[model samples]
Target: VASWAMISNFIDVVKEGRGTFSIQGLGDPSGRGRMISFVKAPARGGDKEAKKPAIIAGTKTDLRRLSMGKAEAILKTLGVPAEEIKLLTRWNRINLIQRLSTAAAADGSKLGDRYGGFA
Candidate 1:
C-alpha cells in the first residue's frame, strides 16, 4: 500500500480504537492478501472511565509524508472539529519539540540539525 494509505489506516485505528483489520493488495506486485492487527495501549492507572485526548505528532519527514489536508480530513472523518484539529496539530508539534529538548538535555547530547536547529 502507499505510505499515505498506511498512515490513514493507522490514524483511523488510533481514533476508533483497536481491532483486527485487513489491508489487501499490499507487499506484492500481484496484489496479494494482507492482514493487520492493531493493538492499542491499555488505559493508564487502570481507570477505564478516564478520557484521553487524541493528538497526532510526528517528525518533519513524517509531517511531509502526511500532508496537513489529509491529516485534517482523517480527523474530521473521525468527528473531530476543524478548529480543534488545527489546535491539536499545533499543540502536538510544540509538545514534541519540548519532549525532544528535555530528552536531549537529560542525555547531554545536542538535538543538532535533525530538529531544524531546535537544539
Candidate 2:
C-alpha cells in the first residue's frame, strides 16, 4: 500500500542522508532499535498454514523531514481512514504511534505464544 511505501521511502531517505548520529540524551525511552520494523510469526507445524501477519515496533524514530501537508497528502493517497489519518498527522502522532506499537507488540507476543517464538 502507499502508506507502506511512504514509510519505506522515509527510511531510505534517512539512511541516505547521513543519519548516522544517535544520542543518549533521549534516554531509556529510546532503547534498542531506532526505527520501527515488522516481524512475523514462524510457520505453523511444517508450513502447512500460512505465516502470521507482522507487527511494527512502536518506539521507532522517523528521521525524515515531513511536513504536515505532505503527510496528509500521503495518507490521503494511501487510503487511510480519515479518522486514522487525523491522528497520524496531528501534532506529532505520538498517541497513534504509541497505540500502534503497543498493539503490534501485543499481537506479536500472542503470536509468539501461539507459535513458540520467532526465529
In terms of lDDT, the best-performing candidate is: 1
TM-score of each predicted structure versus truth: 0.23, 0.24
Stretch of 10 with least lDDT, candidate 2:
19-28
The whole-model lDDT of each prediction reads: 0.48, 0.43
**Candidate 1: which pairs clash?**
none
Kindly report which residue stretches of model 1 are placed more than 4 angstroms away from their true locations once superposed.
1-64, 90-119
Q: lDDT tens string, model 2, 1-119?
A: 25685455456546565222222233223466564432211234346777754433321334134456655554454345667777654545434433443454466764323322111
Each candidate's root-mean-square deviation in Å?
20.6, 23.6
Cα lDDT of model 1 by residue, 60-119, tens digit = 333334456665654454345777778766446444444554455466653433343332
RMSD of 2: 23.6
Q: Report the lDDT of model 1 for residue 4.
A: 75
RMSD of 1: 20.6
